[model samples]
Target: MDVNFSKQGDWTIIAVEGRMDTVSAPEFEKMVQERILQGSNRLIVDFSKLDYISSAGLRSILVAGKNSKAKGGELACCGLQGVVKKVFDVSGFHKLLPIFDSKEDVLNRE
Candidate 1:
């Protein structure tokens, strides 16, 4: 998986590409933790280019979400589609976290 960071207003955008599986989940988790610890509380995880996600990937999202909440900020997700969206819906993550159809959708809501 490849992760890229950017900013939009008060939100930190994390754009992930490729597959987020056990092998790559840890790296993704670490990146998120570092960002949160560095004071990036408002987060948007963009999964548009991600083709697959395993349970480990889900765990990373859970951790990031919790960490953000603990810091009095929120974590949202965007660009969920195909298997990734299915996994999230089946795992009940669709209800646990805020999800947008696209990055522009999230931004428009703000």
Candidate 2:
């Protein structure tokens, strides 16, 4: 998987592409952890280009969410589609995390 970082107002946007599986999940989690440690607590994960995500990937996201919450900030996701969306829905993560149809929706809502 490939991860790109950007910024929008106070939010840090993480755009992930390719597949987020066992091999890439730790890297992704580390990246998020680094950002959080750098004081970027308001995070938006963009999964529009993501094609697949394994349970490890989901665990990474859950970690990020918990970390963000612990810091008194928030973590959200957007642009979910295909299998990624299905995984989130099936795993009950759709309700666990704040997910939006797009980044704009997340920005506007929060």
Candidate 3:
């Protein structure tokens, strides 16, 4: 998997692409960790280009979400569809985090 990062105001947007499995989970985790260490609070994880995600990916997301929330910030997942959305649904993330239909919806809410 590959992660492309950008910023808009106080929010850090991470556009993730490829399969987020066991092998790529660490990379994703590292990117998130770096952002957190840099004192970034608002995190918008854009999954529009993501094709697949395993449980390991979920773990990374869980950690990131927890950290972001603990720091008095917010973390949201945007642009999910197909089986990728199914995984999140089955995994109960739809209930855990603020999952938005699009980037516009996410930005508008903020």
lDDT of 1 at 93: 100
Candidate 2 residue 75 Cα shift, in angstroms, is 0.7
- Top candidate when judged by lDDT against the true structure: 2
Clash pairs (backbone) in predicted model 2: none
Q: In model 3, which regions exceed 4 Å deviation?
A: none
lDDT sort, best first: 2, 1, 3
lDDT of 1 by residue, 1-110 (tens): 88999999989999999999999999999999999999999999999999999999999999999999999999999999999999999999999999998888877895
Q: State the number of backbone clashes in model 1.
A: 0
Point out the higher-scoring one by TM-score: 2 or 3: 2
Stretch of 10 with least lDDT, candidate 2: 101-110
* Candidate 1 lDDT score at position 38: 96
lDDT of 3 at 102: 77
lDDT of 3: 0.90
Clashes of 2: 0
Q: Please, what is the TM-score per model?
A: 0.97, 0.98, 0.96
